[model samples]
Target: MAQESSSVLARPFSALTLQQAWRKTNENPEITKADVALERSPRQEADIFVGNLIDERHGGPITIGYGRYARGQSLTEAMAVDDVMIVLEERLSVSTEAGTVSAGPGEIVYMPKGETVTIRSHEEGAFTAYVTYPPERPAHL
Candidate 1:
């Protein structure tokens, strides 16, 4: 779901409430610290991940959702698509080959596709809303 896929509701365009999106994906378990860090299979959560939002597969495609990382949880990944994460609560840090960026509630951070990055939460951990792009699913997702 987050890694990528053909965009849904993009061609005709539609409006959906976050509540609706949650309803669509809720039957599935929310991604936890281990699912993302060790498993490298966030897309597995997509069994119930129903539909992409407003964009094309390669033309700025993105999927949206939220997840939580326990305090001290961390992971390094080779990104499969562009990731836009908004810290909903607490703080999160993303470190890449270039440098590192950190943010707290209301702040947003971006991690590009095809790069290796390390993600960690602050002592309080983090909860985030994310938009991931490219519409093409990846095994590592």
Candidate 2:
């Protein structure tokens, strides 16, 4: 996985098991409200916990991962990258100055680049799989 991630190698190892992927993230549930308070990144604090189960940020054009947000947590910030989030559990809401939208399990939400928006979890919290473009940020950022 490390080799493929760093060099963009096409080693499509499809034999990976679900358990391995879960273990990669230590099967973590959430990042806890206490931890969220301790964190300072406005862009992702409300995202709770994120896992790079199949990290593609080393050199790939896009990266994949999963994230969990505890109930009532929210993040409002200008997006630094484009994101496509697929809801895996519960519900999610993305709000912009223009309006707001909500999606439930099995639904998808997309937030474009440079847009300032608020993302939050609903009553039951949220779990999602996501893809982000331009895997690595420019150094000046």
lDDT of 1 by residue, 16-131 (tens): 44334444555445533222433223533311112233234335545654556778777776877887766656777777666666677656677778777777777887776667
Off by over 4 Å in 1: 1-61, 136-141
Error of 1 at 51 (Å): 13
CA lDDT for candidate 2: 0.58
Q: What are the per-residue Cα lDDT tens digits for candidate 2 across 1-141? A: 112121111122222452354345454544222222222222344537665433353455675666778899898867678877776677877877666777775565677887787778888888776667766243111
Q: Following a full C-alpha superposition, what root-mean-square deviation does model 1 have from the true structure?
A: 10.8
TM-score of each: 0.56, 0.63
Q: Rate the local accuracy (lDDT) of all candidates.
A: 0.54, 0.58
C-alpha-based local distance difference test score of model 1 = 0.54
